[model samples]
Target chain A: MKVLVADDEPQIRRALKVGLERHGYKVVEAADGEEALDVFAEQSPNVVILDLAMPRLDGLGVCRELRGWSQVPIIILSVRGRDDDKIGALDLGADDYLTKPFSIEELLARMRAVLRRVEAGQASEPTAVTVGELTIDFARRTVTRGGTELHLTPLEFDILRYLALNPDRVLTHRQLLTRVWGDEYAEDSHTLRVHISNLRAKIEPDPMRPRYLRTEPRVGYRFLSGRS
Target chain B: MPTTRCVYSYAVALAGVAAMTAALAALESVRHIANDSMLYLLVVIGVAVRYGSGPSVAASIASFLAFDWFFVQPHHGFTVSDPAEWLALVLFLCTAITVGQLTAMLRSRAEEAGQREMEAAALAEASWSVASQLDLDHALRVVLDRVVQISGAGDATLLGEKAGAHQVLAQVGDALDPAEHGLLVLPLGAGERIGYLVLRLPPGRELSMAERRAVNSLALHAGVVLERDRLMRVEAQTQALHEADRLKTALLSMVSHDFRSPLAAIKASAGSLMAPGEPLDEDTQSELLSGIITAVDRLNRMVENVLALSRLEAGAWRPMVEPTPVEEVVASALEPLSAESSARVEVSLEPGLGEVPVDPVQMAQVLYNLVENALRYSPPRAPVEVRAWRGYGSFVFEVADRGPGLPLGSETHLFEPFWRGPGLGESARAGVGLGLALCRGLVEAHGGEITALRRQGGGTVFRVELRREVGR
Candidate 1:
């Protein structure tokens, strides 16, 4: 797999290159957003790790340009407290984001998750999926926890199914609303919150410490399964 | 006529002459009227006193005609039969005309004097209004209302131009229509047109010279008031900028020391580990690696605190409040601590205590900062307690530590930015003193309050109380 790392700081890029190369992955580097796009077109890397602040063009601009013609998974690297920019990148179709000062292990985990999602998209659909003690049957349209059926409203089931299909990926409120309730209800996050709380109560063993469904806070929700 | 006063004055002149003639005729039937033409002169003087020159002259001419035609020898005719009587009648006419002209002149002089006095009073009142009221809207309204009252305008509006858009600063009575014929637009300010006064007078009515002058002075006063307001705003802005500059300088000096120390340690440790000449032992290498990690963690914490402080000062961070469980907040707060540190800390929440409305992310940061402070101050292996409960009409939480109590008279000073406790030697655990300040900012942004008090027996307790229903 080839990974494109675009950041203005030379130390961060060098550190990432060494870390990924030691993990046996081919690493391509770019210093800014424009070069990032150029390298992305030339090398056609499998995944791109883009930084938010750069000279010439910023990360959001690059994310928008790449998403215009490419579906290659992109993860945004942003500084803490830039919640608006992170959400903007996510809304512009970036796959995921990691706040700055993150460890190499965390970055590798994000990369692997996005790659797994892409592969899942290309593969044939599965009839049933299981993560931990929770099992969902797409064909049967039912959810079971440890071999016993858990009752769910139709709307709750639909929300769960959509999240399950895109596990370990941060889905924005607009994306989820547009998919489940159609475009007319795309901005009704309050309604989405009510349904999510109900769904969490039924599925998670302890709603306080969620094991499957995780909230990204001010962004959206992420469904975490046992595997990457 | 340009004014209704002109038309009313002409009608009064005609009516006065006719009334006097009728009275003379009625008196002649009752008794012998000696010099009855004198009654006509009375009418002429009355008209001259009330109305000015033109109507008084008309009254004089009308009185002469009526007296000669009604009471002379040849009745209903302008001729006088007897020469002495005719001379007497002609003399009466001359006396009436001269007296009417003199009285009209005196009346006008008095009217002008009254007008000047009224104009002075109006100007003084407007000046006082502008000077007394610091509120620009009220002052402008007073000036506009005075303009309308003195100028006899049906309505008045003060239109100010700001950034190429016209705004109605103050309006009195009805709105002035631009299409109205009697609209008077007076531009304000001495050099540039800062604003304008639009007045709508009654149809066919125009302002007298004195009224116009008074209105102009009032408009000028409004302009001065606006200029003064602008100057005040600029002064306030400059003061705020200067204060912010001072804070930034202080922050920079303090941050540089904190940042460089950690950076220097990390650089030295990394450099020694990467050096080629000497191979270090395994234990020494491990120690160096751990040292580097510790330095990086300190730098990261400092960076977070600084970013949070700056964002708070800039008013960029607003709490996105939602209903959040207390357990979740506590869990997230503890998530960042090392396993050993987390085990040392004890968490006790009120059973059945449900959710509270707050920004979970920010609330967690507040709890984390407090808990971290408590853990840092307490002796090694001494338990730091985190408690949450429902207070009276509020949600309250406290972080208690069994360590050294707060310094005397330093309870409030503990929340000021860059305030470090004295007597602590330079060590790896020392903070940049921004954590508590950031906690206060975050809590207050949610319309909540945070306080620190010496614990009853041993240590200190940092308490935070948030409104149950955040009015956002």
Candidate 2:
């Protein structure tokens, strides 16, 4: 994998380049946001990690311009670590965000996750997600519990599919809202909650004490498989 | 000059007697002379009320002479032929002079009362108008308006001293040159003159006693208002200084306590790594290297926290909102954790969990801080569970660690900056206690809230709630 690390800090750029290269990835470096765009066009790196603050054409601008044409996974690195900076990059279609003083391992993992999601989008392959007695067939857009067909609204089915795909992992309300209802509806956690309860009523043995679709108080919900 | 003024008074007195005698002569042709003396007394009283005691006394004496000359049988100069006529003239003279004196005294007293009432009304009205205005300039203007009205002056100007020179704050009527002479300038305020109230009267006109009194009262009212406004401004400035002082104290404490430890650690570790001679073993060197990195990281974190706190207090941090997936934020936050720490964190993300409109970077920082705090407080193998879900119209994130729960009564101050729990072990007191405070600041910046609770299974659970946007 070829990864481009664009940062104004020499230490960070050098460290990331050395560290990522050691992990069997070709590393490209840019001193600023403008240079990052130039290097990105010329080298056509597989992934790009951008720094928010740059001398000219900051990270948000670059992210916006890149997202216009290529759906390349873009990760932002911000020293300020303010919400606005992160949200600006994300809203402009950057794939992920990381604050400064971040570990190289975390940056690589985010890059991988973004790239994998892109690959998954391109493959267009359907898969079956089975958790406990509930099974979701992505290809057929069907869900069954214990070999019996369970009727579900399309919204409920989508919520379940997303939860089942990432079993045992906690998803935030915002994540669910954006994925299911698009980015514009990302803040509508109430709608997500209602749908989640409805999904639980259908799949969970007891809606009050959900087994498959479990509520993680103050967070979101987690789909815990029977095995872990 | 004195005799001439007396002659004018006697002339007025003679005119009153002559008019009265002519009228009595016409009445004598038909009516009896019983009330003739009483008619002369009426003329005496009228002269006393209109003019003063000098003219009235002269008129009373003149009427007696006219009565003796025209009506008494001996119609000559001032001689009385009968003794009865002499007695009647004496009684008439005594009664007329006494009535004239009494009438004059009552007239002066009534005029004094009228003047006092007018002054009191003007003072009351001026105070009401000035008190209604909260702004100093506006109050001065109202006072100037009152000044012109009450003084009957052609114009009025209020001058405030600035840099040793008077500047006009408010003016009414014709524009008067600032250099114009003969202005009725009264100094306003109690001690040092805050301003001057200048009134220009009409040409050759003088203010009455009541008008002069009204002007003085209005000036006093204006001074009181101006003084109050100055005090309020000084009070606001003092309040701002106090707030700045408080921030400085907080910063000093933070620097003294939080900033020093990491610097000391980094210095010691770097010194060992760069030491001369046989060079340490590979294991020892790597350990020292990691130590150096950890120390630097801690220092960086402290700087970021301090900056964040200042930014929050300054109200400079504005959240850039976007649709952020909670799981993505949690995952990103966990990315920096060591392998052992990562293993200890048990993340249970609700599937199909949608996005929330928030500043994801701030939210991620909140998650990172909570998780990091949990790691520090708990044993290496003890599990820390991070969970997220939707509740009502909000998204919730909770970081629960199986560590010693917060000390009793410490939960309330958990999110306060630099607040450390008492009776903590040395290892538990490893951080500067800014993590939770920064998390609170970041979360609140997005219109969210953060709180802490004791877990039922003996741990501390920090919960964050971000309100969901309704109807997009």
Best by DockQ: 1
* Per-model TM-score of chain B: 0.73, 0.58
TM-score to true structure, per model: 0.78, 0.56
- What is the interface root-mean-square deviation of candidate 2? 11.0
Per residue, candidate 1 scores C-alpha lDDT tens digits across B1-472 of 3557888998899899999888888989899778888888777888899877788888888888888888888898888889998788778878988999999999988878898888788888888987888899999988888888888887899888777976889888876644567579887877987888899888777788878888898888889888888889999899879868866875775666667787898899999999998799999999998888888878888878888877877788888888777776776677677767877778888887877898888998999899889988999989989899999899999999998889888788789877666765454444436889899999999999999999998999999999999987
In the range B79-196, model 2's lDDT, one tens digit per residue, is 8889998999989999999999999888867866887777787677767766676767776777787788777788888777766887777888766655678888887866888887
Once fitted onto the true fold, the runs of candidate 2 whose alpha carbons sit more than 4 angstroms away are: A1-4, A24-28, A33-46, A64-71, A125-228, B1-243, B246-250, B270-301, B311-472
**How well does candidate 1 match the true structure in TM-score terms?**
0.78
Distance from true location, Cα of A152 in model 1, Å: 5.3
Highest TM-score, which number?
Answer: 1
Q: Whole-model lDDT, candidate 1?
A: 0.86
**Chain A TM-scores, all candidates?**
0.97, 0.70
Docking class of 2: incorrect
**Whole-model Cα lDDT per candidate?**
0.86, 0.77
* DockQ of all predictions against the true structure, Cα-based: 0.26, 0.08
